[model samples]
Target chain A: MKRLREVFLSALMLENPLMRLMIGLCSALAISTRVESTLFMGMAATFVLVCSNTIISLSRKVIPDEVRIPVFIVVIASFVTIVDLVMRAYFPPIYARLGVWIPLIVVNCIILGRAEAFASKNDVLASVADGLGMGGGYTIVLLIMGTFRELVGTGKIVMFERTLVSLGSTFQPPTIVVLFPGAFFTFGFLMAILNKLENRWWGK
Target chain B: MMEAARTYLLLFFGAAIVYNILLIRFIGLCPFFGVSKSIETSIGMSVAVLFVMTVATSACWLLWGLVLQPLGVGEFLYIPSFILVIAALVQFEEMFIRKVSPPLYKAMGIYLPLITTNCAVLAVAVESVKPGFLKLNIPYHYSLPEAVVYAIGVACGFAVAIVMFAAIRERIELAPIAKSLRGAPIGFITAGLMSLAFMGFAGLFKL
Candidate 1:
């Protein structure tokens, strides 16, 4: 339990991918523009990350060193395909919004990085803990970004049928939030803000 | 033939400047952020990208038109075809570079492999296949050569943007900025500004 707590805390703070390591900024920047899209993307990524890590951890010893990266990519690509197909079949609307991004997930360094770094080397239990911790951290970052970008872009956060978040009705959607520059600027600004907050909370 | 030449030129310039393979399109960012810090390295990497992207676009166009679409595997062919084309393109680029320009190849050494997964190169193929991205109405039954031209043009757009950003970043380094704004902050700012600037090209030459 203590170890699990440590993993969770570290993922949120010390080893945060977006904040500290900056491993998964690609998807983070792309999907954070809308709340619903972020929610869908975050769930899809978490599912892949958790399941892929578990499978990789289980099959670690059987795989040869030379063929590891290829196998890892194959595994990731398969999971991404699964997510892509299922979403297209069942959740067609969200699937439309996240069409190429789901496939793009195969290249998302977070899943592959976790598979190599923590999962392959660790036990199943530890891998699960790592996955949950990291996934939560990623989700939180996405949620915050989604809230900001959506609320700023469209002046409301509409997630599927649920209008769970709203900044203000009067706030006009900043046209920039919907564009590419908005993604870049938001990422840089938010990173700085997070860094500042982290430093203030626990400083040198 | 005149129309073909005109379309090709339009595609090339549009992808490079107005659409910009990197800043506006969100493709080819792996190398953009990775190697843009150094001018010589960025130039070498960009030139390498220009070569592979042009080839990958052309090859994938052929594969898609000649093989994949005909076999009733249009939708599913994307990922598999992409990987195959990218793998082959990387190998070809590696061999060509080593043979033609030894020093440049040596400079780009490992970054060449990084191009295999570069989103920009992948994006060029993806976008060109779609008419709107390339800003061209190539009709439903477009030929392989047409696809090749579209892809090359988009990749060239990527080459143009990266080379431009690479040049800009060189000067940015010389300017005395705060420590936090040194590398990534400036890059982000440049990208943000470029994206903003590129918006002016919207509907300038619509599909």
Candidate 2:
């Protein structure tokens, strides 16, 4: 029980993929401009991560040590293709928004890095837990970013083309919040805050 | 003849400054922040990206056109096929570099292997096949040569942005900045400002 808890929680907070490791920032920064898109993107990534991790962990022994990297990439790319096709067939709108990003998930270092680092060495159950935990952490960050960007950029929260909440008409929306510069500013500040929180938590 | 020249020129300048892969598209953020600390390392990474990106793009395009299309498996097999080509290309590059130029290989170090997964490299491959988003200023489908030209343009753009960022970061290291904004935070903020500056160059050319 303790091991399972640690395996899961470490991915969320202690060893967060983006905040702490900073491996996967491209998709995080790009698809996070809107909450609805982020939600879909995060779920797609989680599906890929979970499925790929489980498969990789299960086949770790059979994969040749010399060709492991290519093997892992094939597994990941196959899963990404599944996500891409499913999202396109079911949710065309979100699929259009995501576009290249969905396919780019195949190259997301977090998935490949985990497959190489953890899944290759761990049991199937632990790999699944790790995937879920990391995926949860990634999704949480995306939700925060999407909320902040949407609220500040457009002065409202939207989901599936419906307005969830609005900051009222009097609020002046800053256009930067929705642009490339805004992504950098928001990401930098979030990293700073996370750094401070971690410092305080560790008393360092 | 004249039209092709104009398109090539437009793509070169446009991708290099206006729609930079690193700053604008946000395709290769990992190395943009990871290797931009030093101009030397950044230059090395830039060269590595340039080589791998151009080769990977051309190779994937050829695979799609020659192999996948004829075989009628281009739709579902693109993901696995493109990745295999990229991985193989990276390995080939490593071996070719070691044999031809040992010093360059040592300089590149581990970054070459990392190129296989670089989104920018993958972006080049995927975008070459799908034509709408990149807006290469070409009229119809991308030919093999056109793909190579666009790949070189994007790679050069990546090199220019990364090296420029590295030079700025080297100077930022000397400046006395705030405690919290010293490292990656300041780097990102500076990149944001650069991105804003690049935005000014948008719409300068119609093509």
Candidate 3:
């Protein structure tokens, strides 16, 4: 239990897939314009990660060394296909907004990276914990970025067509915060903040 | 002939600049940051991407039209099939390049394997075949010529963004930046600024 917690915590903070590892930025940045989409994207990615990690961990022994990469990709891609079909059927709006990004998740380096680095070598339980932690960390960062962009860019936060937070009309918002470049700027500053916090606390 | 030439030109510029796969669409960012540390390496990466993206997209395009669509499993199977196509292409390209040109292989060989996971290649492949995927104001269901041209344009856009960013990063290395923000953070910030500049190119050409 403690080992699982350690693995989870390390993935959550010390080795965050987005902020620290920086493996999966493309979809994170693109879908982070709204909290709702980010939440859904996060959930989908976590589902794929956990499932693939578990399957890969169980079958790690049978998979040949020379063919592991392709095997890993096939595993990841199958999961992504599941997410894609489900989203297209149930969440048409998000599926539309996310568009090609949904399919692109197969190539997301985070899933492949973890599969090769952790799941292949670790047990199924640890792999599940790592996947949850990494997915949680990724979702957290996306939420932070999404909230910041939506709040600042529009001066309000709305999810599911409901206004969750509003700054009122007195405040002016910078439209750029919601655009493509804003993603880069927001991610850059947030990562810097995370770096500062890590350095101060860990003394590294 | 003039009309066809003009359409191709518009498609190229539209993909390469107005809707850049890297800066604007935000695909293939892993390599955008990973390879842009040095201009030389970025150039190598750029060449590898250009080669692989064009070839891979063409192959996937053919596969989609020939195999997946005919089998009626394209909607569900495209993700896996496209990925497999890209992974296989990258491997084949590595071996083929090594035998054909040693110097070229040395320049681009290492980056080939990495391209297997670069989302831009897959994104381009899917977008080319699927109509309305990009929202680029162009009609979809691209013919082979159009798809190849669009792939090349997207690759060129990626190359332009990464190579230019690499040049800037080479200079940024000399500047005194905060320790925390010195590396990837600052790179993102720089890309943000560059992306803002790219936005200015919007409406310059409407296809």
Candidate 4:
């Protein structure tokens, strides 16, 4: 239990996929323009990551060394396709907004990286903890970014067509905050703050 | 004949400049920052992507058209099948290069395998077949050659953006930048500026 806790906690902060490792920034930046879509994308990615990590951990012993990468890709890609089709069938708007990004999750290094690094070496339960923690960390960062972008860019945060938060129409929202440059700007500042906090707390 | 040439030209410039895979579209950014520290590695990665993307896109196109379309399972199986094809293609290219061109394989190092996961390559593979995305003033499905050409254009676009960014970043390394902004923060800012510059070319291929 302690080991599981450690694994989960480490993924949340110490080994945060986006903030620390920077393995999965592409989708994080692209889909984060809207808070709702970001949440959906995060959940979809977490589901895939958790399922793939568990399966990979379970079958790690039986899988051949030569084709392990391909095996991991197959597992990850299948989950992503499931998410893609389900989203298309159920949540067409978010799926359309996400566009190619939903399918592109197959190449997301975080999933493959965890499968190769942690899952392949660890037990199934430990891998599950790691997957959940990492997925949670990813989702947290996405929500933070999405909040900033949605609030600043459009003066409000709307999820499922409902306004969760709004700064009023009189507030002049800078449209740039939701564009590509704004993503870079927001990511850089957040990363710097995270870096400073880590340094202060851990004394690098 | 003249119409085809114009379309190809428009496609090349459109992909390369207007919608650069790296800066503008935000695909293939992992290596864009990771391996783009030096011009040499940038060039090497660019070439590797160029070769792999062309072959992978063509193979994916053919697979989609011939196998997936016939089986009527293209919708469900595309992600896995395309990924498998890319992985297999990378493996084949690795073996072929090791046997046929040892030095080149040694030079490419890790970027070759990394191509399998580069979203830009996969994006090209998926987009080139989408009827709406690939309409190069042609109102139909992309032919094999057209798909291959567009892939080459996108790869070239990636190459151009990365090489340019590398050159700028090399200079940036010399400049006395601030503490926190030295590495990736500055890199992101620089890329943002470059992206803005690319936005200037957005109206180039306007129909």
Please list all clashing residue pairs in model 2, or write none if there are none.
none
Give the worst 10-residue stretch by lDDT in candidate 4 chain B.
Answer: B130-139
Candidate 3 residue runs with Cα over 4 Å from true position: B100-110, B135-139
Model 1 clash tally, residue pairs: 4
Residues B1-207 of candidate 2 have per-residue lDDT tens digits of 999899888877877777888877789898888888788888888888888888888889988989898999887898888988888988988898889978778876777788888899988888888644445444356778877888888989898889899999989999998666668878888888888888788888977
Number of the candidate with higher DockQ, 1 or 3: 3
Question: Regarding lDDT, does 3 or 4 come out ahead?
Answer: 3
Model 4, residue A172: displacement in angstroms?
Answer: 2.0
Top-TM-score candidate index:
3
lDDT of each residue in A1-204, candidate 2, tens digit only: 788789999998888898888988999988889999999988988899999999999999999999899899999999999997898899988887788898899999899999999999999989999999999999999999999999999999989778999999999999898888888888888887776776678866
Cα lDDT, model 3, residue A86: 95
Q: What is the TM-score of chain A alone in each candidate?
A: 0.92, 0.98, 0.97, 0.97
lDDT of 2 at B81: 89
By DockQ, the better pick of 1 and 2 is 2
**Which pairs, if any, clash in model 3?**
none
Query: Could you tell me which residue pairs clash in candidate 4?
Result: none
Worst 10 residues of 1 chain A by lDDT: A191-200
User: Residue by residue across A110-185, what tens digits does model 3's lDDT show?
Assistant: 9999999999999999999999999999999999999999999999999888999999999999999999999999
User: What lDDT is obtained when candidate 2 is compared to the true structure?
Assistant: 0.86
TM-score of chain B of each: 0.84, 0.91, 0.92, 0.91
lDDT digits (tens) for residues A156-177 of candidate 1: 7676678876766676778788
Which candidate tops DockQ?
3
Total backbone clashes of candidate 4, pairs 3 or more residues apart or in separate chains: 0
